[model samples]
Target chain A: MESTQATNHVSYLQHKPHKIGILNWILSTDHKRIGLLYLYSIMVFFIVAAFLGLLMRIEKFAPGETIMDAQTYNGVFTVHGIIMIFIIVIPGLAAVFGNFFLPILIGAKDVAFPKLNLFSWYIYIAGAILALISQFASGGAPDTGWTFYVPYSADSSTNVIWALTAAFILGFSSILTGLNFIVTIHRLRAPGMSWFRMPLFPWSIYATSWIQVLATPIVGITLLMVIAERTLNIGFFDPALGGDPILFQHLFWIYSHPAVYIMILPAMGVVTEIFPTFSQKPIFGYSAIALSSVAIAAVGYFVWGHHMFTTGISYWSRWFFSFLTFIVAVPSAIKVFNWISTMYGGSIDLKPPLLWAIGFIFLFMIGGLTGLVLGALATNVHVHDTTFVVAHFHYIIFGGMGFAFFAGLHYWFPKMFGKMYNIKLANISFIITFIGFNVLYFPLFIIGLQGMPRRYFDYFPEYQYGHVISTIGAFILIIGIFIMLFNFFRGARKGEIAPANPWKGVTLDWQIESPPTLLNFDEIPVITEKPYTFKKEEEA
Target chain B: MEDKKHHISSFNSLLMVLIGLFIMTGISVMITEIHFSTFSVGVALLLASIKGYLVLTYFMHLKYDEPIFRIMVFLILLLFAIVIGITFIDYLLR
Candidate 1:
């Protein structure tokens, strides 16, 4: 269905630059370059956070203050949470892969606004710098945690205001990127590419952009209010100053809850794309998988009140929120089931990407099921502030979204760089990461059920056994992470040359050169069929 | 896209909008001073909302923008209003 004109000569990497060296990359308006830039920067932050997490686990290995004091432990965990939530996962797949592939997947050359896309990276870097400064700028590292829950945040001697401001700026960065994607998706589809004809990855990005645009402002305003509370003595959240703390919780979760969707939706998009490609079948239910992302994004907003359940909200509000939270699982389950159905009776390749995708489904199911337990008013009371909540979120965010990120990276690595990493090493790393991840987190559930609290430097002797196992597991997980990073880094420099369509996928991105040129298409592709149809070869 | 001439409010109309906003603010303050204590918040919110509406419609040119932009904005407002309504349910019940 595609009609090609005279092709562009240069691949994107070979495209000439106006500036030399680092400036060429930094100033480049190519979405692919910017995507790689985001990938590199985000990986650095992820590594930092991972190391901090390892330290936390190390200190937890024996008992009280194994390596650091309580205050230091608190600060480390808080910074880890900030880096992971704000810097790594919030932007996550959509920022990295979405920027790289959204336009190409939809048969467009570039996002609607390339300048804004580059500006967003700069803004992200600026926000990262400001956030780093917040930790070291004042009395000490901010101990308020990433949520910046007030009273403590307001009263804390640390530079909470700077953290708040940094978060505010980062929110702007997120909003701009979201806005760019939304407009690009809306306005830049090539000729004859209808809404349903678009790939699921772009579809999920569309849904995610809406969440980023709509929900991020609430957190931005809330963080600013905390800044105001600290500086202007605004009595908004500090109970000592006649402010209601629950209100702060309300505002915080209002954005942060939906923010979870911002993290997971693009990852869900990745899984949807991977399922059809690896399974060698059209998706079992295209509309269901595509619309489920939107459905998840929509229902995700109303469930924020679930986070405040143990914080003494009223019975009716708590029950209402609990019910709403339960309702969200239906759409999530639909997507998960459809992914499995797509693989049924198909020629499954069992590639590393597909393995990670399957891994995501397993971990996300556990995460989502445990979420129901936390969503219930009765069980929430029992698990609140315990390692239970910590384990539950890690299962979802790290296990589900993190796994999906790896899957997308492996799936699209060839497309991004025109080379393939070692498949054997990739598979090995996935297995190790998966095994270590479960090992590290599973014991937390056991000990948490027995009443171990999270964010503590010390634990009872009874809990020490669990912590010891978990620390060992953490070491395994870190080794896996390092191996995975090493595999990618080594493969990028030296790997097999990948074909244009390595997976024999039917999406628009596969129709192009492996390392696509600076302008994606020579002649803008004219599309006529649904994105995932595998019937092109015989017909052509 | 930017070259498309959206409907622009005249200087006279913008001035009128500003004046209306000022009068609403003044009337809102007056109502609070006159001890409409129960409706004070309601009145202030109403007036502030009007000023916000005027600014958005004229200054931000939503009045001239496409239907999709209007729908996006209306949806955002609806989301906020729904959350506020839910909050009120808990507070009023308490």
Candidate 2:
């Protein structure tokens, strides 16, 4: 099983400089290149989706001077959510960074199945193409939003079938990637690396992978039913054929709610890695952080019904889900406590990565705590579909997950490309993105409390001011993201060569040289202690 | 390393799980004849669980993988249980 000393010979290792053909990039199976490919493609989709979001905000900026009509606004938000959830966030961190570094971090030459990883990318692209095609084929991208709840999803005038089918295809891709990562982690850890010794990012990805393999199929089947009922007139979810609409709500949320975890869990892992590296200390309660990941995944499953409390779920079940939802918060809080404890009395470096990690903790705390307010049966009934709910999720998803992602990208940019980012520009980008995100989303909490419902193209005149402020914030957020992107692009190509461990981290991935050779390591290293057991001499 | 060897040798267990899954699929389809509609779905899912268990233990080689992987598989079943249980409770109470 050990192929020690043999030169690593992955297929794309021999890629000549001038051989950068479209077919070469498309057909390649090299994990690093594939990861870069995913990074590029997902970023492209993110920009497109962000543009749609900006359009939505602009249309609503002044209570509708008529930039985009109501129907178009619906299409805009739906497409924005679809692209962001399906295209960028879900795949971006895991598929790009996970694929790039997990095997390398573990001292493996490649994932157990290289070909399957490439195929997953193809499936993702295919799903993306099908969804994009629907924009032109019918009325527009499905206006049902990403959740695509039953009656609306089943009966929407737009091309809902294509979107559902695309989602189903993407689910298979996600499941396969999950299965691959699970197998790789199980079978291919470097000789000395025990499960307990693995890095937190991989630990987080492991939890996310399990969620993906299990929950993804349910969504696959659920969406398949959506397509089936529409095409064959089955009564599985469509209300017209004796199918209960609430059943659709159940089936949809069963997957969609956990889907939120799928989006957040990996970012949690990324933040877990960053905290240790930048704080200049081993993570406090390492086992607790690792186990809490699993805890969140396990508890995440029971709480999907919280999303449906407003839609007339049974009172008993509502109470049960609401309780479980609150229970789920405990583990998340444990993670926050562990992170804060890691920073306590430690020689913390306020580097860009650490800044974002701290930012994530602050915003995620706000989000997770507010989530309890939403999970309570009484409180949710009032704010269920309002901007409060929207704001809460944005805090968690965008503020929590999005900021961590930025932190991770900056932290690893040097390692990924053997270059150093412009710290001044990175800091500026961070400030703009953070402030803009808060400005864009925080106002929603206030307006929502004042009775502003979400998903509306236009609103009351008084609300117009809030919407305008939010729209301006969205612009600032986009500019910040662009600046970050530009800095990274320039840094990667021309910046200073990164040392093997630029941040002086102790993870196995940092043990390897920057821009590692195709096989990651010449020899599979063994581990004996916790990953961040920093030597006392290095501390001083 | 120990887990990998065990998985490599569990070829028989994998086959057994496949056979069991197919059998459960047959039983689920056959149970449509039983007059109780809710009972049929329950039986079908029960069989499906057995099949799921078999696959988790054998094909996925979780039986030989570390305790954590096994814990993961169990966690998934627990989740499945909660979803089905709550949904049925609501369905019946209604």
Q: Which CAPRI level is candidate 2? A: acceptable
Which candidate leads the pack in TM-score?
Answer: 1
Could you tell me the lDDT of residue A276 within candidate 1? Answer: 94
lDDT of 1 at A210: 91
**Candidate 2: pairs in clash:** A192-A526, A192-A527
Candidate 1 regions exceeding 4 Å error are: A1-8, B1-5, B23-41
| Residue A347 error, candidate 1, Å | 0.8
Q: What share of the true interface contacts does each candidate keep?
A: 0.29, 0.53
For model 1, state the Cα shift of residue A532 in Å: 0.7
lDDT by residue (A262-372, candidate 2, tens digit) is 888888999888887877788999999899998998889878889888777778888889999999998898989999898888888888888888889989988998898
Q: Which residue segments of model 2 deviate by more than 4 Å?
A: A1-24, A538-540, B1-40, B43-79
Instruction: Work out how many backbone clashes candidate 2 has.
Output: 2
